[model samples]
Target: MSKQELPIIDASGPGTACCAPLACKPLSETEAAELAPLFKAIADPVRLRLLSLIACHEGGETCVCDLTAAFDLTPPTISHHLKVLKQAGLIDSERRGTWVYYWINPEVLTRMSALISPASPAPTGTA
Candidate 1:
């Protein structure tokens, strides 16, 4: 199968948060459409854990073999979860020798975090 290029979020660029914080402003239809798939991809319990494992792995990357051992499901099931994370642009993978190595895409995570992060509190006036 051909490798798919994951979406890259430019967190450092101006107005690159993908959307304003959830409580700060309502999302435009286009923004919601673009962001919903990412949330959907990670909504599954297996995929959520898979994402956490990859992000927390030492050196920020891990092989498919390592991930499989953490779950009671078969390797294929783990692979499927990885694929969902990959397709959501949450994680990236590369085939190294006999195993596929995966790592989190930090920019996407940053954008997601920024979107959901609480807005800063208003400053209080001193009497």
Candidate 2:
């Protein structure tokens, strides 16, 4: 099969940073629709591991060659997973000579973390 370049969403779009935590407020229709694909992209076991590997790689980025070594799958299979991540905006990549280097998009990770983070505890003592 041929390699395909999927459209990348701008994770910095409106409402991404302003939304309340999941425990504090239900996701608005737009928010859910926007985020579902991202979550889905990471839902796959291989992709999730690939995301974690890229996030934890030294220097905050790694080459496709390194990623392929971590799994038993073929390079093309690994590339497919990486492509899915890139499509979801959870990761970004650049071609360097014969290799592609990948890195986590920190802003998107921060937004995702904030969305799932628990709300602060209520004050124990009333004013």
Candidate 3:
């Protein structure tokens, strides 16, 4: 159950992989069931685009109105997608007067990035 148990490729290390290859063992049914919804949320293109749009925005956040304009979808459609992102812990929201603003959660991002790849560097002999 350690992070090394996952498959991870780190470009930072001359194409070195930092974690163990996936197990020959299949995921337990409970584990697969647990992971299903989180991946399903990201499987939608609109949600991924919304995440990218917000991520690319300066200050790492954007008003819901600002997000609505980027697509040719109804407000409710956008709201549904944002809801999925929120549920997945990919974004956080705050209300300011009439608008809802969302920003990426750095902590969650860091956790995900590390899950994708693990990197550990120790100072070598006081260098």
Candidate 4:
């Protein structure tokens, strides 16, 4: 399907019923379809590590050289993985002179986290 065909999630938009935690209720078909690519992007070990490395880096960004050093794979392989994460909207990059740097799109991660995170449960007994 074309990118436009998938449901769009607006994190900053007014809240909707769909914002409720996944464990609290089932996802609508649109929600599921919209999120599947994000899940798929992080399903691979390399991409997950790349996410962590970029997200946790100092100054909120990391150079491609830094990311490549942590993996045993060739630069092309790492680049391909980074491309997937970029396409999934998990990360953003910019070219500066000779090098490219990447940073996590915090809003996207926050939204994803909020979607999967459970709400606080009621007290089981009197506090």
User: Considering summed lDDT, which 10 consecutive residues are worst modelled in model 4?
Assistant: 1-10
Error of 4 at 79 (Å): 0.6
Q: Which model is ahead, 3 or 4, in terms of TM-score?
A: 4
lDDT of 4 by residue, 8-112 (tens): 444443243444367767777977888878889899999999999998998999999999999999999999999888888888888999999999887666667
lDDT string, candidate 1, 51-101, tens digits: 889889999999898899999999888888888888787888889888789
TM-score of each: 0.78, 0.75, 0.67, 0.78
Question: How far is each candidate from the true structure, as Cα RMSD in Å?
Answer: 4.5, 5.5, 8.2, 4.6
What is residue 90's positional error in candidate 4, in angstroms?
A: 0.8
Question: Which tens-of-lDDT digit does each residue in 101-127 have in candidate 3?
Answer: 999765544434443332342333323
> Model 2, 1-127: lDDT tens per residue?
3333323233444244433357766777776777777778888999989989999999999999888999999989998988888877788888888978999987666666656655532333422
Q: Which is superior by lDDT, 1 or 3? A: 1
Q: Which candidate's lDDT is highest? A: 4
Of the two candidates 1 and 2, the one with more favorable lDDT, higher being better, is 1
Q: Please say which candidate is ahead in lDDT: 3 or 4.
A: 4
